[model samples]
Target: DSDSKQKKKKKSKASRSDEDYVQSLNSREDRNKSWWDDFRESVEQAEPEGTGKFLFLKLLLNETCEIGDKVLVFSQSLGVLDLIEEMLKIASERGEGLKSSKGFYRPWRKGRDYYRLDGSISGNKRQNDIDAFNDTKKARLFLISTRAGSLGINLFSANRIVLMDASWNPSFDTQAIFRSYRLGQEKEVYVYRLLAHGTMEQKIYGRQITKQALASRVVDSEETGRLF
Candidate 1:
C-alpha cells in the first residue's frame, strides 16, 4: 500500500509539472516573466482596506499548499464577501502584502491566482474552478458563501477550508465543512472558524445553535434559541 501511494504521488507530481509548464508557455504575459512574478505584482498592487478581515486573508494566502490544492473560503455574509473582493483587488495591485496591526505577514505558498464566487461564474468555469483548486494549475484561492457552495457542490478539488464566520446553525457549518470532508480527499481537511472575542457574536452563536437544533429535529427538552 505504501509503495502504491508513492507511485500515485509520483504520477500526480509529473502530471502537474507538465500542466503547469504548459500553462506557463500558453500564458500571454511577457515571455520574460514567469507566472509567479505576475501573480506577485497583482497581489501587491490590489488596494485592500486595512481591516481585520484583510489581516485574516493575508494569513490564509500564506498557508502551505502544494500544487493542485483546493481551498473553500466561507465569509458567511455577503457584505464581508464584498469586502474580500476589495481586498483581492488590492492583492492584485500590491503583488503580495500582509497589512496587519501586529506587523507580521508574508507570502510562503506557491499558488495559482484566486477566483471569487460570483453570479457570472457557472458551467465549465465553475467546474474548472473546482478542478483548478484541486489541481493547483489554476486555483490557489476559492472565495465562497456557505449557503451557495455547501449544497450539491463537489469540492474534492482541494483540502483546505476557512469559514470567516461560523453560521448560527452548526449544521449549516457542517454542510460547509463537508464540501471537502466528503469522499476521495487525499489530504486532511482543515476547518477554521473565526470568532470575535467578547462581543454580541457569542450570543448570536448560542441562539443559532438552539434554532438549528430545533429545525434539525424536535426535542422536548429544548426551548427557544432565536431572537424572536
Candidate 2:
C-alpha cells in the first residue's frame, strides 16, 4: 500500500509538470510574437469571409448580371474602387460567371466586361471606356470615383446605380444616381445605397436627409411668398 501511494504521487507530479511546461511554451510563443503578427491575426479573424459590404455587393452584382442589367457602382474613395477592382478580378479568375439572360453570356472579364473611370485616367482613355461601356453588350459593370464621375458624364447604358458609400454632400450622391437615370435610358432605374448600421455612413445619410428637407422647405416658402 505504501509503494502504491508513492507511485501515484509521482504520476500526479509528472502530469502537473507536463501541464506547466506546455503553459510556459505558450507564454514564450506569445512573447515572441510581434505587433504585425498580432494585427494580421486579428484582421484575419475579423474578416473570415470577407467584409459584409463586399459580400452584399457581390450578391447584388450576381442578381443584376444574371438578368442582363448593367450596373454603375460609385464610391467616394478611390481606395474603395481599387479594392472592388481587385475583388472583381479575383472573381473572374475563379470562373464566376454572371450568367446573363442572353443565351451566350460569357464569364466576366476585366476591361471587357467591366470598366473603371477615375481622375488618374487620361481624358481620352476615360471617354474611350465610356464609349465602350455604352456601345458594347459585354460591358455590364462600371466602377466610378464619385468626385470624378459626377460631372459631365452620361451613363444611360446602366440602369442600376450602386452607392457603395455615402457622401457628405447629398448633391454628389444625387448626381451619381442621375448618371444612369438620363434621357436615353430604356429600362427602369434602381438605386441602392449600402450603409453599415452603426457607422459614420448612417450619420452622414441622416444629415443628407435633413439638409434636403430644409432645402425643400425653404424653396416652398419662397414660392408661397412669391405667389402673394
Top candidate on lDDT is 2
Residue 41 lDDT, candidate 1, scale 0-100: 54
Instruction: For candidate 2, report its TM-score.
Output: 0.74
Residues 185-228 of candidate 1 have per-residue lDDT tens digits of 77878777666766666666776677676765665565554543
Where is the poorest 10-residue window by lDDT in model 2? 17-26
What is each predicted model's overall lDDT from 0 to 1?
A: 0.61, 0.77
lDDT (Cα, tens digit) per residue for candidate 2, span 98-192: 55665333566778899988665667988899999999987889998787787788999999999999989999899999999989999999999
Model 1 misplaced stretches (Cα beyond 4 Å): 1-49, 65-69, 97-112, 118-120, 208-228
By TM-score, the best candidate is 2
- What is the alpha-carbon lDDT for the whole of candidate 2? 0.77
